[model samples]
Target: MSVDKTFYVTTPIYYVNDKPHIGHAYTTLACDVLARFKRLDGYDVKFLTGTDEHGQKVEKSAEGFGTSPQELADRNSANFRELAARLDCSNDDFIRTTEPRHIRSVQALWARLVAAGDIYVGHYEGWYSVRDEAFYGEDELVPGPNGTKHAPSGAPVEWVKEPSYFFRLSAWQDRLLAWYEANPDCIGPQSRRNEVISFVKGGLQDLSVSRTSFKWGIPVPGDDAHVMYVWLDALTNYITAIGYPDITGEFARYWPADLHMVGKDIVRFHAVYWPAFLMAAGLEPPRRVFAHGWWTNEGQKISKSVGNVIDPVALIERYGLDQVRYFLLREVPFGNDGDFSHRAMVQRMNSELANDYGNLAQRVLSMIGKNCAGQVPQHGEPGADDREMLDAAHGLLPKVRDAIDRQLFHEALEAMWGVIRAANGYVDRQAPWALKKTDPARMGTVLWVLAETVRNLALLTQAFMPAASGRLLDQLGIGPDARTLHHCGSHHALKPGTPLPAPAGVFPRFVEEEGAA
Candidate 1:
């Protein structure tokens, strides 16, 4: 199908209280891959990711670090930016809530809601969980082991009485339910959508939108003593980065994002609260909210308190960046929780990258270099096996497009690898090395088909393993403009007689230091 619509996607603005770990990296990487795929598919894409710099947790972290809130935000937010670079994320904008643009946007949204009578002053007397930065209703609290009541998320809550500005979340229930019913696919993966539906059906209390006790957040418009709730402040980063409240620019082009990729833990904020807030401000809600599951370490849940958070930087250092990216996306289904294990990572990298993909590319390119004078060779009359192999490679583009459209990343990779695996089998059965001595013309034809397949595979691999894909494309002598989805389905993709660069491996096998090669 032809796609002409603009594609805008956002990762949840990570909290600035801590540095990035595997969880943060996973969400960012998913967004990056989708953005890359959309761009390659001829869509105008804007990718946004950054830090949620204002919250009570950040304030407490600042105090614990013996620094001011702004100072802590600056330091930690910079770390997030660095992580994006390390992961090779191609985000168009990195928004921080403390920026002047964001503050203006947040305050402007507050004024709009206030003008619409969605905001009202009220007394908030309930159980609050600082860790979750949320209020739990009396019935939602679970009994803790120490005779204390905890939030449903297992975070301890304290009863606090304070004056705050309330958002008319309760008033939007019928409207939200109607909106959701009208748009059945608004929330992704079906399971997440059902969770949101159940929560809204259960009923919503008017949420506290302004917290008087938190002095580190954006101040409510016309009420300087009260700061807007951190979620109200943070979720605005999506539009704030896109130039909201000013209208008719980036905001007009990308305001209603095509997707909001978030973790499952924050489904309510994105699926329920964010849409209601947008509707209240006379804005369109995003097209979809996809909340993906989390990860564990070696079958054990990873937690900061347990000291089991896997550092992504360390993983990248041990395994190549593209290898790590490939393993993460290929190892698990996109919307399901995955486990991270060193053994799994090593086995996947060594077997898939080194054995299947890398070996095929190396074997074909080396043979071409030796027999065809290091140039893309010409094809002869197609034999039956050659036709089937080329057809498989030529047919991959649509399958990849379909898989990526649904965020089925693993399926996309699997489709590409299927072509590679077939090419491997064809190479062995045809015995191109034997054909070189017996019939040179047949050898050229076989090598030509394999080269074209590798070129298309490398092009498709860009969305997931850009660095390694670039190396493969360079070795194939493919040009920059020709390496997009527009040319992925062509049978005559590789230009015959084009000089190819010397063969070098793209994906290196992982080995332990004790068994150094």
Candidate 2:
């Protein structure tokens, strides 16, 4: 496909100390959907995801396992890479912070910050959370059980004293506020933007940019003893993956990423610290950062201690791959917390996918096979119902594009499903099967409209469920080369008498085992 525009989207590089869970999959899948949509719409898209391997937590976890940090990172980073493939993510690149390219990029960024006078050596004494890899002020700590103090994220904090390098975060406070006010849509979901603004407004403190105590991070540019702080190193992965420091080639094309998809917990880092670092280095900040919420398993918080962490692989095994993919984005609003229940998953599959969309395709195509000699039926003439249904199918592109531009995945899916639901209603009212017996010519016209509608639905769904939608389009005689957003609507309607494959169910009804969780 020829492309004139470019889009770059990224998932927060998953921390290698942690296992790949549904949360990781959720973020990456959202990026994948957007990337695929843009590519189909004729944009040159770059979708990136990978692992963050350096930090005190990884060091501690490596010691606990009696292994070197690099060994642990290699093993775990491989798992995240596999998860992307397992989920069929169309990410163009997978980056690891430990890679030589990333090291060079991070060091280059550090040097640029130093040259800009944004970095200064200083003494640091404060509360630190190894779990969160962050420094929290005394005012931000909350009392936990047993009189222990924790960061706002509930990670335990401890007093630490060391010589460190600090980023001039306070110096950029006014500039950050001005930028936020000028670009209101840069930080997504409105609520997240407001929260970030409040934090910056309350106060700004110079951030400790290097940790003398941790040996598992990128060392500061001119000092070898103090390693760069994890967040600064981690956020650099965005520009690094796109080829920064060189300032040309991929960097020139795709820098200032179109979107950064991260969890709500790290909104402060991406929305605040990341941009400050880039702008300090005389670079453009990313276009947007969307912080999505977490997920609970069956009404309980997903915790490893509770043994309730949802595994993306297990989900795909239990349900089909496309079914699992569809449910994750559809189950909740993109920026709100959602619960995962077996009953709800089954309901969506059996009702929406199987009954509403699957049945619509199966019955229409099956009738054509039985009555129209297994070929695309030609439309007879214009009719009110036919015109209305076709118009709705054609109208979906703009609604979906608008929602997706705002990172509204659930809203975009709803817009496509609106057309699907309407097509089902049209099928019932037209009753092509009865027309096959009463009026053959009218039956052909109704079947033609339904087939065209299915073609549009399949094209829209390709971004969400590629394999299943590809199969559906195959049944409609829509070849792989013909499957793009440009091919949707009445303008690209199915050719008459085109040979079509036999209809088969794409989304099967998911059945639960009696003893299943």
Candidate 3:
């Protein structure tokens, strides 16, 4: 809660076997919004995202593409970088496993785990899902097509037997359980925590950490015959970005990251394996791991075969970027699955944004422009309705902050919209145009109250909707330094008689083609 503390948050490094999709954009956008909120909240924030380019799956994909693994990684990783830019992501660093710095850190972490006696040579014979890049016990497999076994996740598995180095995951099960007990908040969204707890309760087996079957990974230290498991190399990217192992600068400032935002499919890696690995290496685990669910398109699972895989770039092209950004977090509660539909998107755009928030800015700022000689108006004597709306606006910061802190993005947006709704109602009741003739002072007060409220709303919502909010702030005569929470909350006055630009609607109604939904 203190501004002096650092907030380090990360999205899971996306696997670079293919191009970016709605799922990847969704997670990175969430992290971006949180990072922006923290910076506006006065925290020193370090946000990270990147591609996980090392793995057997990537190698196979490269072969299919008629390219070497590094060539494939180079091409696909650039796509992710381009996607981040297109999405307006504010990630502080973008790391790839192929980077020398990352390779060094991964190897350092491996040596640390090895030195701690938590890793040993072993033979692994199990059901391996190349798609999932995970090994499963026979009992955990379900029937698949062609009489083959699949992971519970339905990813087809192949029986794999190989020489591998194993991490003593079973040895740390009790320690992990005890750690979870001591720090119950470490894994979030009670349902996710319960799922993790239940999984650990079923017991853990020693995990194979090095793969000899594939050479498209970080080579194990002192062993050229094997490569470190992809997850180990990938997860260590967090520390690598922060200058870990050496432990200076960013590492010293933001080690033991405040949050690891991952998808539900990979929760076990962060909640179980990651923490155990950290503790075994004599390091502290991350402060929290919050796993969010997947997204669906039009009530069906999103897949390439379905011809409905939502391309983030195409979605942004179809809808405005901030509009897409706003709907993603606002339509769904942060830790739950959500569906994307054109109908839903249009509704959110036209109603919540265009009508509720954008309309308020347009109507009140327009009134100020016409009535107050095109400048911010001064307040009149305090009145009940004015104070009520002012109270609602003033109360917004803490409420939004509380929701954002809990990662309840829907709650935050809803709370901001509550104040916005009240401001709109105040406009209807006072009818500022009528006041121009008789109660001019009261009208000025109303317009002033509305402008200040709109200013706060713009600044507050900027994290969620940057481009649109920037336009809103520009119309209100606000600039960069004036947009922080401290500035918004200080009861500051916009410069009276400061000439303002004509306001324009930021969110326009989305019109869908026939049968689009």
Comparing 2 with 3 on lDDT, the higher-scoring candidate is: 2
lDDT of 2 by residue, 147-244 (tens): 99999988899999999999999999999999998888999888999999999999899999999887999988779999999999999999999888
Candidate 3: deviation at residue 399, Å?
0.7
> lDDT of each model, Cα atoms only?
0.90, 0.93, 0.90
How well is each residue in 1-517 modelled by candidate 3, as lDDT tens digits? 4746699999999888867999999999999999999998889999999999998999999889889999999998999999999999999999998999999898999999989999999798878889988888877899989887889998889888999999999999899999999998899888999999999999899998889888999999999999998888888999999997898888888989999999999999999999998899888999999988899989999887878888999889988999999999999999999999888988999999889987889898888888888888877766988888888887899999999888899999999999998988899999989988998988888898899889889889989999999998999888777888887653675666677888787888777778863
Candidate 2 global CA lDDT score: 0.93
- Mind sharing the TM-score for model 1? 0.97
Worst 10 residues of 2 by lDDT: 1-10
TM-score of each prediction: 0.97, 0.99, 0.97
Query: Per lDDT, what order, best first?
Result: 2, 1, 3
Which residue pairs show backbone clashes in model 1? none
Tens-digit lDDT track for model 1 on 258-314? Answer: 999999999999998999999999999988899898999999998888999999999
Deviation in Å, model 3, residue 365 alpha carbon = 0.8
Q: In terms of TM-score, how similar is model 2 to the real structure?
A: 0.99
Clashes of each: 0, 0, 0
Q: Give the Å error, residue 79, model 3.
A: 0.8
Q: After superposition, how far is residue 395 of candidate 3 from its true place, in Å?
A: 0.7
